[model samples]
Target: MDFGILGTLEARAEGRRLSIGGRRAQLAMAALLLRPGRVVPVDQLMAVLWEDWPPASARTQVSIVMSGLRRTFRAAGSESEIIETRDAGYRLRSERVRIDTLTAERRVTEARRAMREGRTVEAARGLRAALALWRGPVLGGLDVPGFAAPIRRWEELRWRMAEELAEAELALGHHHEQIGDLTSLVAEAPYNERVRALLMTALARAGRQADALAVYRDGRRVLDEELGLEPGRALRELHAAILRDDPAVGGPDGPARPAPGIRPAQLPQAVASFTGRRAEMDALDSLPPDRDRGSDRHLAICAITGVAGVGKTGLALHWAHRAATQFPDGQLYADLRGSRGEAGGDGPASANVVLQRFLRALGVATADIPDDPEEQAAMYRSLLQGRRMLVVLDDADSAAQVRPLLPGSHACCVVVTSRAPLEELIAHAGARPLPLAPLSRDAASELLRRVAGDALASASPAEIDHLAEHCGRLPLALRTAAARLAARPRPAGDGLPAPRHEASVEALEACGCG
Candidate 1:
């Protein structure tokens, strides 16, 4: 027979639940399950059944309950050897029964091992499986007097593990999807730092930087007003990173120092035909002053975002090239692959892995780079301190993925590009958002002329407008249409062109934009 005490005290024969008895009998089985394979002394049973006082007939009542429990076990199809009778009291035959508390504890151990090995998905699954065993509060209906402490401790363990499962989900880049659940978790556990931090991280990753900071504010107030303590270092640092519009840049491992004084010029060559975004560039030149907390609109780092092919990276590169002369410290850039699941052609680059490269770019020796992502961020931020450098984090995946790359202080500017807005930078790091919209028709036509050269010059303005229409007025699409027009041979003998679906514009665009 399988018995469960993590919730209601019940037994199952062949996986079907069975109610064994009322309060007195449940107390007997639970007492045995609590210390399976050992004898539960009769006096202790009397103490639990009758708190602070026991009647003269306590022994007789205990004997009757024990007899009833044996009958219930026998009726549940257990072998006659399930419970043993001893002169002192009784011993539960552990080998003959299954206990859910024991089962769940085993799963917890396995999950912990999986987590230690960085198998977070497996760990999360295991934790969820383990937590699923509890149907309700441990020993809900049959609360024995003097049994509160152990039950409370066990409940605490379940909650902690539940929070851990949420953290694992966050680590896997399910930032936007987990917001609702995480918000509920935080509400249920306001003082729980893990839940609060995870909630903030989820919000920040989902382009709700303001909400993320507000969560911290609320959590901080709760901690201060209730616990009389300040927010921990991790939460405070996260708050600070948001204020900088910088990627936090933490990873799985620790520190390393690469070759010293090695300023990396990692910026990609700017697009020669890059055009427009004049207003955005002007806005970048002027920024708002720092506000209270870490919310600074005039970002030391700026994030450029828009839909796919809207030219986020191209804009950042064009502006970076223009401002390159001012940054004597040097420029560094990485295609973070934040949006389309890949920064380049490859898969998304985790923050820890990218921080390793950034550390090397700053001239620190490889041996000195920390294996931990946070340590690398600290060193990277230190090297960029007071240096007029430009860091381009392109195609980022999430805010946590970028936080380590952000410098803690000033004198360096970073330009980040993504298909979707990264609101964390704007909310906390004083990042200026330069959202790129579709180019105007005039701009689109100009871009096409510049890209296709004389091939497009022969076409009438009406034809060009048709082509632009087919190109969706997006720079990437327009360039593609221009390239296609350039490749096709002009009508032989100059026959009048027949109207078509503009087959050259297949909605196919380049692998990247800005």
Candidate 2:
């Protein structure tokens, strides 16, 4: 039996071909393809099917779809097990299948690494090969909410990879060849400043300096007229460098220096003030120490997991920031993209990738790190065996997604933030979970004081209470409201507009809350 997901859905067995009919089956197939070999939880599948509001028969409908997909696979003359039902949900066995999406991703990652290492020619070849695997959008005929997030993410990655490939080609002195493709891309995505910058560089490299300057001017005009924002710093600098005929701008040697550090930009925009969770934070800090000195029995692994935008991350970060001094070695932060539509975008970071990054942060050289993921993870654990490092794994998708990255010794503490409560992490890894609740009335008022400043201090106690109640007592919503109030002009003679409790009430009511 042969399973091919690189293009259209095709499973071949013996001498016959199987037909998968209906849009639902196709969508089911697409979802399975996204994860390939992992079990997509039943609840998550239901959410995908109904998107925040599953009908009473949603579970039954999902089972029916799975059964239909199985029959379709069998009818295609394949005795292969395409889908397997588990205790939680279902898994698609893709061991022998040729999945184009996986292939494309693999190629693109390889090309990106090669390009980073100055192997432009190899990068271009690998990227071109990867691009060739994409015939069209994945499961084009299917329109399911479950598929939309992953599909959109995949499409965006595809375009990013394509842009990288074009840049690689230009670096390889194929500027003449890249002109047409870059032109088309620029037309299609005029607001993509990165693409425009690349086009200008390509034009300049191909001896069209005047055209390159025109490209920059045109891009700047478009941005100012349509978006009313200046070009990004990088684009503006590139334009200036081109105008001055700076050799370093389009030279084969690339930029003269690397950026200062590899750290992700600090969370610049302030999150809404945290409300409630003080007891939860205290409980997290009070977890029992490990008993075994030679083994990891004492230090607790505390996991904060909940639904998206439910303040799991907010609570974890707030607590971690406050408790930074406890873990004197360092405070490590990673956005694992565990839950989509929650924090970061889709496509959670792999455990190996996270481990590699963490190890590097701990002063391990890139070359010193082992190539095998298992070895890398082991090395990471070994490094953290006796250290008191505070590691925050934010937005984790699953237990398996984070298992390998765990610190071996109990001396170190790990705070994980996830959308789903990882019961197994608690049972198996001795992880303590701190469930977060919405803010209390007093806590909400204090948060408003922090955000609204003196203006909130003068507001009537009754109005403040009404405002907090209206904001659903959720920290994020309350902060937004407070910020709104702070931005408004101060009232005359110490008098303010009447508190619009009904407006806040209506907002919460729309969200199905009090």
Report residue 349 deviation for candidate 2 (angstroms): 2.5
Superposed on all Cα atoms, model 1 deviates from the true structure by an RMSD in Å of: 21.0
Score candidate 1 by TM-score against the native.
0.49
Predicted structure 1: lDDT: 0.74
C-alpha lDDT of residue 349 in model 1: 71
Segments in model 1 whose C-alpha atoms lie over 4 Å from true places? 249-514
Q: How do all models score by TM-score?
A: 0.49, 0.49
Can you write out model 1's per-residue Cα lDDT over 194-221, one digit (the tens) per residue? 7888787777766677888899999999
The candidate 1 region of ten consecutive residues with least summed lDDT is 249-258
Point out the worst 10-residue segment of candidate 2 by lDDT: 256-265
Please provide, for model 2 over 79-116, each residue's C-alpha lDDT reduced to its tens digit, 9 standing for 90 to 100.
67778998779998878566777778789989877654
Instruction: Flag regions of model 2 displaced more than 4 Å.
Output: 1-276, 288-299, 307-310, 341-344, 493-514
RMSD (Cα, Å) for all candidates, in order, is 21.0, 14.7
